[model samples]
Target: MTGRSDEYPAAPKAARRNRGFEAASRLLRERIRTAGESRGFAVSRLLTHWPEVVGEEIARMSRPVKVGYGRNGFGATLTLLVEGAAAPIVDMSREQIRAKVNACYGYNAISRVVLTQTAATGFEDGQAVFLHSPKPKPAPSPEVQAAARATAEGCADDTLRQALERLAENVLARSAARAAQKKG
Candidate 1:
């Protein structure tokens, strides 16, 4: 038939075009994966060995603050948030923190380190610095648990939350089945 003959030509061209696209896509994916690993390594090295680089600089400061990742036009920035109204809160400005972070990183990648004052109580309460020991225990509550899980999700911090979410779904399904049986 005429239809069969026409389909034959289009089929070969479609197969060839698909194959060409797949090859190009595979190459681009490989390149992106390699570049991601390189950039990830750079960020990890900076964070992992941060104390050695910034420990002295932080020590010199009277005000105690917590350091965490920040963001702006640049990819990942560092932030210094003051924790308390303690006497040692020497009122260092954002610019000072930025300068210190830049010097520590040995790169201008950090656009800035913004300073924010938090109303939370200070290290004077004898809570050890988080870097030095295990994190303090939080009181158990459903709201607290949900918030912790959601925060973990937003941070892209770990796989544990995903595992927990999966487990929670199973538990919920089991409970629903039990309720249905009871109603029946």
Candidate 2:
């Protein structure tokens, strides 16, 4: 038998090297890119960073649907899915939207912006979910907080008491607001 062992060939240096954990986004990037390409999106950044590309107000009312490239592939038309009621508002800001989208690509890639209005519930695919940021609730009045604390005073557990106090505060504050609204 020869001095060299041929039973098991040595593994490649790269394979032997320890590869630590990778980010989920890095692993799924290729899959995301492939899916985006199928929808005529050359770069997935436009879809992923829609909110950042356009302002929060515009993003809340609309979402990017797809990009359509012409036969020559010189200029592409970007289609935005907008809320039915916000169609006119979005249409008015078409130029601004187009400019922002073009700037995102670092070139005037988008020739025009098209808005497609959808019903209140949005499309069949359920892609358009109009999410509005919840307004911060005002702090409960001192009287309301005291009343809430008094209600939770009977609880022995510190954590449970604190939770009950918060619940009472919210309930009392909401009722107070309703009463004030009726008076106004």
Candidate 3:
């Protein structure tokens, strides 16, 4: 009150600096790690990047459920939820699966893989969804594209014409694929 007015003290320079918004992933990383740990996944990459850790073929038929560590914490067993029909196929590739999972951790973290077979519809434990990255659609053939362009040539607007051409190409390609399947 002597010389200065009754204004509140200024915030520290570090706190005053405008640190822009943070990404959702960055903000939730620790929470995600904690949740993954509760599910016995020490390294979250195995769950997040399962398709990349294992080949697409394996990932398509299986999903990592949990990791059960030994009493000594030396050899962990990875449990995979697999479709009933694919269980045998996955069992045959157990060693390969173990190797791939261990490689993902950069260590021999998983000693074995145990398969839990379930119906295609999955179980009631809220693990029913088994999804993977979609396979990329093949490019339409040159012939199909040319035909589509020809069909769309009557359209007046350039953008509309291009969109129509894409639609025609997709329809024609799908028909061609069906025809080929019938022939085979």
Candidate 4:
């Protein structure tokens, strides 16, 4: 037993091979649930689907912040961070937003929307929260470049041909880098 790798039981293997790695969204959900005290989870979902739940016009102007649960443990009030001067329009559309959000949840989840207005252009602020750094992709290795040229040789359009060549190079380089990371 002392010499065995299985001397102590490791965490259980998934029942089916190659099928049990959790999606990144699942981890995000668990974090949201734990941090939100239940109310936050729905709020996060609303934020994620905001563009779909509310129309683009409203979504661009407002963002769901916190959910205040009533004594009934249902019929919650949603607090939204909004752009300045747009609160009136956003407030006016609350009923429509609520309908769309409830439709997203497949039932009634938000009873009212509370707006807190900030800058007139909320786009930059909202984008910062979700965007990763915009670092440019590195140049591909010589092997990848050759492969890309070979792959694009059949393309007829000069512009399309160049675009396909670049895509091939990027894809190959990205895959190679990922493999290297796994190996390391």
Task: Identify the candidate with maximal TM-score.
Answer: 3
Q: What's the lDDT for candidate 3?
A: 0.90
lDDT of 1 by residue, 119-180 (tens): 33454464534546778744444644565465457545357767765556555555656777
The order of the candidates by TM-score, greatest first, is 3, 2, 4, 1
Candidate lDDT (C-alpha), each = 0.49, 0.90, 0.90, 0.79
Error of 4 at 89 (Å): 1.4
lDDT of 2 by residue, 123-162 (tens): 7676666579889888999999999999999999999999
| Model 1: residues with Cα > 4 Å off, grouped in runs | 1-42, 57-77, 86-93, 116-184
Clash number by candidate, in order: 0, 0, 0, 0
Write candidate 3's Cα lDDT for 54-82 as tens digits.
Answer: 99999999999899998998989999989
* Top candidate when judged by lDDT against the true structure: 3
lDDT of 4 by residue, 1-184 (tens): 5688868779887687676788888768777666665545454656677788788998888877777878878687877887767899998998988888778768887788788777534444654243577888677899999999999999999999999999999899989999999999
Error of 2 at 143 (Å): 51
What order do candidates take by lDDT, descending? Answer: 3, 2, 4, 1
Error of 1 at 98 (Å): 2.2
Residue 69: error of model 4 in Å?
Answer: 1.5
